[model samples]
Target: MVLASGSPRRKELLNNIGLMFRVQTSEIDEHIDAHASPQDNVMKLALQKATAVANSCDDAIVIGADTVVVLEGQILGKPSDTKEAVEMLQSLQGRVHEVFTGIALVEVRAGNIYRTQERARCTRVWMKPLDRDRMEWYVGTGDPMDKAGAYGIQGIGSILVDQIEGCFFNVMGLSVSLIDEMFKNWGIQVGTKIRSQGV
Candidate 1:
């Protein structure tokens, strides 16, 4: 099996589930469409990553995923710089935002491709009201610079979040339950030690 992402968070998630897989990051345009719904955009990006990585192998099951933070119909990806990260965090404070994570599984056999599954999971997160000093101090940690909406719910940023509805793993960038559901659709029960092409 293969994972088409370079995120350590994603790697950790898979490791926690005891899945043996290789990392194969995909190179694709990740631009978000202003008019596309968060669900549609994430799904498209995930499929693109999966298909791109799958094309390089003769037989392998590849998993690709994309995550985004949506607020008031605007999509927020990973902040490009500290300034942008701070701005994102400032806007997200004291409000409810949606985090959407899309997952795609591609099965390749003898060079033939079988599009197994593509779906998106959403989680609603509520952030505690933060003053400028608090937001700036958090951003100084440099954690938000690499996260969507400029916050890492699994780390120090967790303090900024007041509550959440839906899958907590989704906020972490991958939803293990959703991935298990996809595997079930392919007749593979998770935790049964199912191996793929290699490791």
Candidate 2:
């Protein structure tokens, strides 16, 4: 299997599940069309990422996922710098944002005869109000610099969050429960490697 994302967090999540997959970053452009709905954009982005690599890897099952944070229909992307990171956190303070992760799995073979999946997982993330000192300290840690919504629930950024209303793993990156269902729906019996992990 191949993972077509550059995120270390996604790699860590897969590793934690004991899945054997190779890292191959996809070069698909991720520009969101202004007219596209959030669900369409996320799913298209993820499918593009996976199929882009499927062009090169003819013998592997490819997995690609894209995460986006949306509040009141406004999409918040990765931070440009610490100041932007702080700004994003401050904007999200005391508010609820919806996190969407679109996952795509493609089977590769002759002519890449395969299937494509685009499933969106959402989590309601409520952040505690950000204080000046606390926000500054969090920005200093540099964890928010590359994350969507300017926070990571699995790391130091967790301190900023009050709670999540849905899949906790979706906030981390990939939704394990959703992924397992997807795999099964695709008729892939995940073998012994994932049995211990409750897959």
Candidate 3:
């Protein structure tokens, strides 16, 4: 099994579940389609990443994932600088936003894709009514620059969130239950696989 992403958060999530998998970062273009819906955009990107990595594997299950934050129908991606990070946090403070995480599973045989499955999950998050001082303080920690909406729900950014209305793991970048369901569709039990590997 393989994960087609360089995100440490995704790697930690998979490891926490005791799944045996290797990391293989994909080098495909990640340009987002402005005309596409958030769900469609994320799913397409996830599939592309999985397919790119699966092409090099003779027989392996490749998992790819992408995450984005949407607010009032606008998609928010990672910030390029601390200034943008502060702006992102400023926009998200005291408001409810949706976090979308798309996951793709590609089964490869003989270096060819045999099957593909994709899923997108959304979680609603409400951020605290924070002042600029707090937002800048959080951004100064250097935690928001690389996260969607310039916030990391599983890290120090948790203090900025007031509440969540869906899967907490989805906000973190991957949904364990969704991935487990996809694995079951292929007659694979995550727990069984973990036990077999004695992990």
Candidate 4:
């Protein structure tokens, strides 16, 4: 299997699950089309990433996932730098936001493609109010520079979050239960939950 994502946390999550797979980071553009709903946007990007890699493989199942931080129906992508990261965290501090993760699976054979399953999930996250001192230190570690929403539940940024409603892994990057559901649709079994702590 090929995992089409650049996130180290997602890679670790899959590895911890004991699933063997290859990693191929997708370069697909992620600008959301205004006509598409939030869910549709994520699904499209995830499919695009998976299909791109699957098309090149000899024969493999490709898994692609896209995550976004949505606030008041607007999608917030990864920050470009420390300043933008700080601004994003500032807006997200002490508030409830939605984290959406889209999953897409595809199979490539003889240059032909079949999209197996594609879907999106949303999780409500409540962040504890952060003061400037804490934000500065967290950003200094540079974890927020690459993650969408400028905070990673699997990193030092965990201190900023209060709780989450829905899949906790979704907030980290991928949703294990959702991924299991996708596998079930494809007649594959992921088995059981993978208990992980400390992000």
> Which candidate has the top score in lDDT?
3
- Which candidate would rank higher by lDDT, 1 or 2? 1
Better of 3 and 4 by TM-score: 3
TM-score for each model: 0.95, 0.92, 0.95, 0.92
Runs of candidate 1 with Cα error greater than 4 angstroms are 196-199
Tens digit of per-residue lDDT, candidate 1, span 50-69: 99999997878899999999
Q: Which stretches of candidate 4 lie over 4 Å from their true place?
A: 191-199
lDDT of 3 at 76: 95
Could you tell me the lDDT of residue 168 within candidate 3? 97
Model 1: residue 123 alpha-carbon error in angstroms: 0.5
- lDDT by residue for model 4 (1-199), tens: 7899878888988887777777998887777887777788888899999988887887677899888999888789899889889899999999999999999988776667855689999999999999988888899998898888999987577889999999999888888888888887876766332222110
Over all chains combined, what TM-score does candidate 2 have?
0.92
Q: For candidate 1, report its TM-score.
A: 0.95
| Model 2, runs deviating above 4 Å | 192-199
Clash pairs for candidate 3: none
Which residue pairs of candidate 1 clash? none
